[model samples]
Each structure stands twice: as structure tokens, then as C-alpha cells.
Target: MRTQFGSPIDYFLELGADTIHMNELLGKPLHMKYVGQQCLNCGKDRKIYRMGHCYNCFYELPQTADWVIRPELSKAHLDIEDRDLAYEKDVQLQPHIVYLALSSDVKVGVTRKTQVPTRWIDQGANSALEIVEAPNRYLAGIAEVALKQFVADKTNWRQMLKNEVAQEDLFEFRAKLSQHIPEEVRPYFLSEKSDKWDLDFPVQKYPAKIKSLNLTKTPEFSEKLAGIKGQYLIFEDDTVFNVRGNEGTVVEIFIS
Candidate 1:
């Protein structure tokens, strides 16, 4: 899904040639039918092992390199190849941000400087602010590892999707955490604090309890879309569907 930052984030889903304006589907009955599957990499009829890639594509593609997940393992700076050196250098060598975000709780994270608010929005963070601007993913990632020892590095997805959050000032949190930044990365820390981003999701009512929908498990399901937050489609009957999670699964959805 793609998002446009707004008063409430506007979400879009691209399928084939169609662009689904997900926010418009709110409060409408949606019928979804699982049709088939296709690997995002080679477009083959194979089960996706990870990140919408088939087992082969997952292992073979430069995009799915281990450094993608554990950026600290990146060797692109040293001109060493993990999968594809050119691809690695292109992405891993780009400017990256080490940030503090509040979703279910305050957490430290790393992302390309370009991902910015998109990364935070995808995690359903209520607020976020950059703490460091590093030259590459490795620097930002190493900073993340150091900061995680003091603050969380993972989001509690259940709590995030349920809209259970407490407001907090990221600016103050960033200051307290600055002293703990690894000495090597300290030079990149931002002394001039930028205002934290506060995002509003278009949720009509939040579910007290949530039951996840697995198209593979159930195959066919129909429910009224209550709202959308992050990548999950909130439904009236408390069934939530994760669009990004079901990346390679082909399905047909209709609304009325």
C-alpha cells in the first residue's frame, strides 16, 4: 500500500493497473475471495517464503539480502558483496536516519532518509522524530542496535493496530537518549531538534478485540470495513486483514 500524508493519511493499494483508494471503502461491506498466488520477484506460481518472494527468489534476489533486515551486517561500505554489490551500494550507501517513534511505545529504528514519515506511518506510529542523520544504513543500523539496549526496537503490532497508545513527547525522549548513542555515531546526532510528526489515522471505531484474517486459512470472507490503519483493514466484525503481510497472495475483493 502507498500513503499520502494528510490530516488523516490517505492510503492506496496498487493491483495490476488499478489503484485502490482504500480510505473510500470505509463502512462498506467488502467481499474478499482468495484466488491464487504469485511470487512478486519472478511472477511465478510459487509460495512466497518472505517479502512476497518465492523460496528461490527470496534466496537469490539482491533485494532480499540479509543486510536488508540486519543493516548492521552491510559490507557495501567495504566494497564487499553480500548478494549484489551494485545493488547493495545503491541502497546501503544512501543517507539513513536513526529515529525515535511512538506506536505501542517508544522505540528506536533505522530507515533510509527517504522513507521518513512513510516508515513511521507504516508502523502506525503516533509520533516520530529523527535523532541522527548517518551517511549510510550501517551507521544508522549500528546506532539502532546501541539504542535498543535502552529503548525498544520493535513495535507491539497488536497494541498498535488496536489503537492503544499513550501520547509522549519524542523531542524530550531524543534528548535523554542522545548521551547513550554509540561514540562513533555521536557526530551525526542532530543538536537542533526538529518537531515530531503527529499522524492521525482514519479510524471510526477501534476494536476491543481483534481476530486476524488469513486468506489462505479461510479462503473466502466478507465483512464491512470499519476503517484502515497502517496496512490492516479494520472490519466491523472485528476481523482485521493485513494487506502488506499477504503480499504474494492473489485475491479478489468487491465492495457494496
Candidate 2:
């Protein structure tokens, strides 16, 4: 799903050369057939090991290095290479942001500065504000490590999907968390007097209870599309499918 920041977020689903405006598909009858898993990186039929990559790809690819998951472990900025030095420099030697987001709960996370609102939307955050903007992923990651002791790093996807989030002020959280920012990264702290970014998801109704649909168990099922938040395709029956989680999986869809 592709998202653009707006009063109400705009969502688009791209399939091959086709682009489907997903907001228009809400409340419609939806049918899905799980085809099979294909490694998105190698473009071959293979079981997805993690993050849409096959087993070998997950371990061998420069993009899937350990530093990707744990930014503090990044070595590219130190002139050392992990998998591919050139690839690491391209991805790691750039601007990064450390942020506070209200997703299920107030959480601290890191992402590229260019991915500002997009990262927040993907996490299903109701509101978000940058605490610091570091020069590279390593700095951002270290900042995250420091802030983690005071705030959460993970989102409760279940509660977030149920729309059970409580109203909270990100700016307030940012103020409170600012004291914990590591000294090395404090110079990049955002004090530009900007308001928190808020997002509105397109949903007719939120589910009373959520049943996460695993395409492996029930590869074929049809349900009324209730709403979409994060990357999950919500069904009227409370069954939700996570499109991002099943990235390498091939599927056929029919809607009426």
C-alpha cells in the first residue's frame, strides 16, 4: 500500500503495472486467493523467511544486514563494511530522524528523514513528532537506544488495529522524553516549533474484535472489506490481512 499524507490519508495499491486506489474499495465485497510465496528480492518462488525475502536472500542481501534491524550496530559511518560497502554508504551515510509516535502507545523509532510521515503512517500512529534528526542511521539508532529505556520501541498491532488508541499529545511526550536524548545526538534536536503530524485512516467502522488472517491456513476466503489501517486489510467479520507481512506472497483478488 502506498500512502500520501493528507487530512485523511490517501492509500494506493500497486499491482504489476496497475494502481488501484484502495480508499475507493472500502465497503466493497472482497475475495482473495493466496497463490504462493516468491522472494521479492530475487523474484523466484521461495518460502519467505522474513520481510518478503527468501532464506538465503534474507541473510545474504546487503539490505537485510543485522544493522538494518539494530541501527546502533551500524559500521558504515566508521568506514567499515558489513555486506556491501557501497550499498551501506548509500543507505547509512544519510540524514535520519529519531521520533516519538503515538502508536498503540507512545514509542521511539528511527527512520530516514525523507521517510518522516510515511514511517509514522506505516506504524499506525495517530500522531507523531520528531525529537531529533541525526546525520545518519547510526546516530539515530544510538538515540533510539537511549530513549528506549524511557519509552517503548514496539507497537501493539492488535490494539492499534482495533482502533483502541487513546488520545495523547506527541508534543507533550516529546518534551518529557527530551531529557533522555543522548548527548551526542542532542545537537540535532528539533526545536523548530512544529506541531505533531496527525493521520486519518479510511474506515467505515473499526472491528469489535480482531482475528488476524494467515493466508497459509485459509488461503481462500471472501469477506466484506471493513477498513484498512497500517498494512492490514480489515474484513467485516473482524478478520484482518497484513499486506506488508505477506509481501513476497503471490495472490489473486476478485472484488464485487
Whose lDDT is greatest here? 1
Compose the digit string of candidate 1's lDDT tens values, residues 69-173.
Answer: 888998999999988999999999999999998889898899998998899889888888989999998998899888898999999988998888867778888
State the lDDT at 128 in candidate 2.
85
Off by over 4 Å in 2: none
Summarize candidate 2's per-residue lDDT along 55-138 as a digit string, tens digits.
999999999899998999898999999999999999899999888888798888999988879998888888888888889989
Please state the error at residue 185 of candidate 1 in Å.
0.9
C-alpha root-mean-square deviation, each candidate = 1.0, 1.1
Top-scoring candidate (TM-score): 1
